[model samples]
Target: MRLMLVEDDDHVAAALTAVLSRHGFAVTHCRSGAEALQAMLPDDRAPFDVVLLDLGLPDTDGFEVCGRIRKVSTTPVIMVTARSDVRSRIHGLNLGADDYVVKPYDTGELLARIHAVARRTTPGTPDPADPVPGSDVLRLGAVTVELTTRQVNVGGAAVPLTRKEFDLLALLAGRPGVVFRREQIISEVWRTSWEGTGRTLEVHVASLRAKLRTPALIETVRGVGYRLVPPAAA
Candidate 1:
């Protein structure tokens, strides 16, 4: 993958670039926010796959740069910085960052995150195993999932759902009795392998049960994962 590293510190950038290059990534080191932005412009070269941004840029704040980049391109941006406060994380996500990694992160985890963001952003053919393929709809007892339309309804009534919530439900509902490992769900849904994603996955599952008004619909296997128990009619 083609990656852009935006950091003002030469040593830090050099270290990261070397690591990324060794992993088969074409790394472009940008010393300032302006330089990063200029490189992102439409050019003869193929566009970058992902960007690793540092908040302590020489010319501009990384958050501002992220916002500006969003206005110009759809390339995924992952904020790699020393800011670890809750507010900073929220603010970076609010500015359209695909992921946030605090300093002192494991290189292996960073590589996984980079691949996740790139895969999520890139357009590709639909999985052949996806349940809702032709008509783009799947029905489980009283619950209904419309994949193409991105809608969900329960017993003829519409149930509002965020994007991730719907995705979680659809994944489980596709194979009612099969248990889905937490890691598999996260990788397929969030497209990331970060250990911290487990909490987010749990929250989404709880929200799905509540919204569907079926607490027993999704059963949690002890020390395993989760599975959808199809209703009687289904």
Candidate 2:
């Protein structure tokens, strides 16, 4: 994967670049938010697949940089910061960050998150070599989920969902009426275990229900998990 890593600390950047390179990632190291933003500008070069951003920068705050990036590109941005507070994480995500990774993190977990975000941003297509079953667009009553474009619609009205919210909805919609365990949902959607990430799943579910304007669409199975009931079925 091609990545733009924005971190002011030379030593830290160098270490991360080396590690990511060893894992077959093409990484461009930027010393500040300005440098990172400049690199992200339209150019002949192909756009980076993902951005690893640090909140602390010399020229600008990482949150501001994230907002700027979102205006130009939909490339997944993962906030790599030392801030571990939940508020910081929510703030970064609200600013359009695809994922938030607190410092002192497991390298394996970070790698997993990078792949997860990439999967969400990258469109999936049926292979010509091997026959793959399943349609790209999932229709459930009036709600339509165009998997290839990541667009959600309800009764012909577009529903704007965050990356995580869309992921969650798509997961449940994939198997309507099936109760997906909370742990399973977190693993599949958030790419994290059901530990500190449970609250995130809850928040996304609530948001999806609200945005879809169908509280009954996603039925909460008491003492279990959640299930998707098509509007028609409901």
Candidate 3:
């Protein structure tokens, strides 16, 4: 895979580059946000498969770089930073980052996250074990979910949802009243395990509720997971 490592610390970047190289990745290390952005431009060079971005850079903030990258390209970006707070994670996701890996992470886990995001963005890659919906459209009272287009609407008005938010909502709407365990949801939607991803799932659910304008649409099952409360049931 062609991967971009945007980290300013030479020691950190060199160690990570060596690890990535051993894994058969063509690693391009950029020490600053500007350099990373310049390299990301569409050129004769092979397009990057994934980006591992560090939040602290010499030239600019990582979040700004992520937003800029989104405006120019659709390549998957995974923010590797020390900010483990839920707010930072949510902000990164909101800015179009494909994943957020807190610092002091397991190298194996980081590799898995890289492949997961790359796989999701690859052309013709199927969603993780999504059930075959009877129809392309799924309707739950006032909300309408178009599975094929990945679009959602409420009361005939369009509602924009982040990619993860849509996936979470679709999973729940797929089986209304069927409580999906947290592990199951994470595995199916994010294609990752439960550890370190629970908070992300929570953020997605909260975003979905807010964007859908139906706070009661998704119900939390204490000590379990969550379920979709059909509008009629709500």
Candidate 4:
């Protein structure tokens, strides 16, 4: 796998880079969010399969940086945070992060998460759309999500959603404000393991929030999971 690591800590970056490279992965190290952004652009020279990002960057909040990155790329991102709080994990996931690892984490565990994400996103594995809106357009908040073409619109502006992100949105919007459990969403959105892809739930929710004009509509039910509460009804 090709990995882009955005970390300001020189020792951690170097040690992790060497470890991943030794395991036959291409590693690109960036010291700040700006460097990471430049590497992700079309002219970044190297193609990255995934990103290992540190949340405590000197330049910007990692979550804010992730929100910006999700506007264009679907290359999976795994957040590296110092805190192990659930809210922080949820926030990272909500900001389009694929997975997360707290500081002093085991290298093997990080590699395992990367492999799991990589496996699910294998190239040419056809993405399946939502069963309900597979042929129709969906309206949620200010966004018009086209199922047939996989496009979204908010505030008269075009929005882009990845295949998985769109499917998740369609499922949640099917019953607006109905609190769908984490496992239930996994079954509906992805016909895969609940635990293996639970993090995907957070990623798609984050992506949808960023795309939708009224982000507050996607309500987090605290200990439960996510719910789609349309603004007009809220």
Best by lDDT: 3
| Pairwise TM-score winner, candidates 1 and 4 | 1
My TM-score estimates for the predictions, one after another, are 0.54, 0.54, 0.54, 0.52
| Cα RMSD to the true fold for all candidates | 12.0, 14.0, 14.4, 17.1
Candidate 1: C-alpha lDDT? 0.84
Cα error of candidate 1 at position 156, Å: 58
The RMSD (Cα, Å) of candidate 4 is 17.1
Our model 2 lands, by Cα RMSD against the true structure, at 14.0
lDDT of 3 at 119: 78
lDDT of 2 by residue, 13-122 (tens): 89888767755478999998889999998899878888999999999999999999999999999999999999989999999999999998876568667877887786
Once superposed on the true structure, which residue ranges of model 1 sit more than 4 Å away at CA? 125-234
- TM-score of model 2 vs. true structure: 0.54
- lDDT tens per residue, model 3, 1-234: 689999999999999897677555789999999999999888998899999999999999999999999999999999999999999999999999999999999776787687689878867432333434356888888899999999899999999988888888888887677666687688788887889999998888888888888899999978657888877879
- lDDT digits (tens) for residues 12-87 of candidate 4: 8898887676444788899999889988889736567888889899988888878888898988898987979999
Arranged by lDDT with the best first, the candidates are: 3, 1, 2, 4
The clash count for each model shown is 0, 0, 0, 0
**lDDT, each prediction:** 0.84, 0.82, 0.85, 0.75
lDDT of 3: 0.85
